[model samples]
Target: MSLVVTATGTEVGKTVVSALLLARYRQASYWKPVASGACEGSDSETVQRLAPEGTRILEEGYSFDPPVSPHLAARWAGESIEVERLVPKGRESGLVIEGIGGVMVPLRDDGVLFLDLLVQWGQPCLLVASSQLGTLNHTLLSLAALRAQRVPVAGVVLNGPPNRDNREAIERFGEVEVIAELPVLDPLNRSTVTQAASGFDTAGQLAGLLDQSQGECR
Candidate 1:
């Protein structure tokens, strides 16, 4: 089954972790629907640059000029983001979909949320969180939000310097596994991605999330 990568908030190294996962799982595909930024490039572009060669990256679902929330961005652009059309026609093994912002961000005014897409996909997700002190609250809250919506979690990936205490706290109280603790990269590059990938096995970490048989069509 396809996997999704979401975060507690923006700029939490979610894309970096996605890159590392793609680097480790060479056959994996990456998709980031409803992207808001376009100056530096989309999140899919960042993944394409950092992921291992031959990674199948899909086009963004909807792109906005301003780097703002999907709802605002789409409103400013005079376009409606449709959730029904956003779901992948089929699932593929190692298909890693990335969501914009946090799980609660809205895509449109009809109460469609990023979490709604995750619930529709009905697959487990890898929640990326900061390893800093404030992460405990944010992490647990995000976990609760996902569970409240009936979303299955693949696990958590704390993105920052190793914070054993924070990790333990999340694992103990959050009731979700800490898949890996990714340290900050010195000079973020392909090499850095490969190095970070060593922290977790590609398939081992995702086995629980991938429920459907590989390469199965819908």
Candidate 2:
């Protein structure tokens, strides 16, 4: 009953959405298997700061200093990313996995992609997308790629200013629900994240998809 958080591209609010999911499912543990930009700060650390107190943030599988493509970053660090080792070990339930960059991002020089890893993990994905102008194309393309690989998608989470037209278009064309639309937060702290999470999954649609028991979030 775990979910993978992926996005149309890098910095498109995947980490924020991960925090929101963790807030909604307080018992859920967060794991970012492959992190490329460890030099700045890992998403796991940010989630730990933003998620509810006592939330479990698991250690990453592969961490490289360079903020580049995972393949390139691993190469620069004198290592190679093996997709097999990236899979979660003991945490099979109530885990939220955050992906690096977009769905089609490469994990190695042999052309293995983040999408491939998702397929291997066999968990549904929560696609995070921007609510901006170019999101239609990016979101649709990401969805298409996931569908092409037969990966099950839990739903889409739009991050940024709310746009009705974009949301409608994504649902109509992409044929998936816009589970939640997250507004841009100024301070982006724990209190604000908790407030935002209160509105998310209010109807328990995401909970149903994740097979979580009713009323799990406190």
Candidate 3:
């Protein structure tokens, strides 16, 4: 069972969390299904660089050069994103799949969304969110949306400065565990990523979840 890593919005540390997961779960590989910012750089590349040696970084299902919404980027590139083709190939277990943009972002012109794709994939999700002001609303709303679609949430990962109040609020209202709280590394590198990962899933909670059959959040 592959774990899906997504965020409330872009630049909210999905890649960093993905790297942390890959580092923590040595057997897991990394995959970003649809990459819209190929011109700038690839998240797969960043994950590959940050993840420990021998981490398998799989090829993306769709790659567009424009750094914009996936639907628009596909249009700009004179193409369209087929949701079915985004499925992970070959390896099913021990894979970490990262999503593009936010959960509600459009994936096609016909109004399909990233959330829709997540529902289609039917895998457990680890939502990455900020640990700052306004997270209460964003995190709660995202959790609501995911639950509404019956997407099994593995847990939440808060990335940024530590905020105990926010973490408590999310865990209380959202009814999910704060699996990990990743602080901003002074110098973000493989060493720091490894250090951060060492502190994550220390009790094998996430690994245990992946080992079992998927279940909905209460």
Top model number, TM-score:
2
- The models' CA-based lDDT, in order, is 0.82, 0.89, 0.87
Q: Which regions of candidate 3 fall more than 4 Å away from where they truly are? A: 90-92, 209-218
Top candidate by lDDT: 2
| Superposed model 1: Cα runs more than 4 Å off | 89-91, 207-218
Candidate 1 lDDT tens digits, 1-218: 67889999999988898888777666677888778887657788888789887788888888887888899988888888988889763655567888789989998978789999999889788999999989999999999999998998889999898999999999999999998888888899987888777656544657434443332211
Cα-lDDT of candidate 3: 0.87
Clashing pairs for model 3 are: none
Residues 1-218 of candidate 3: C-alpha lDDT, one tens digit per residue:
68899889999999999988888877777889999989899999999889898888888999998899999999988898999888866555578999998889999988999999999989889999999998989999999999999999999999999999999999999999998899999799988998888888666778854442322111
TM-score each candidate.
0.92, 0.96, 0.94
The ten-residue window of minimal lDDT in model 2 covers 208-217
Question: What does each candidate score in C-alpha RMSD?
Answer: 3.6, 1.2, 3.9
The residue-level lDDT of candidate 3 at 19 comes to 89
Candidate order, lDDT descending? 2, 3, 1
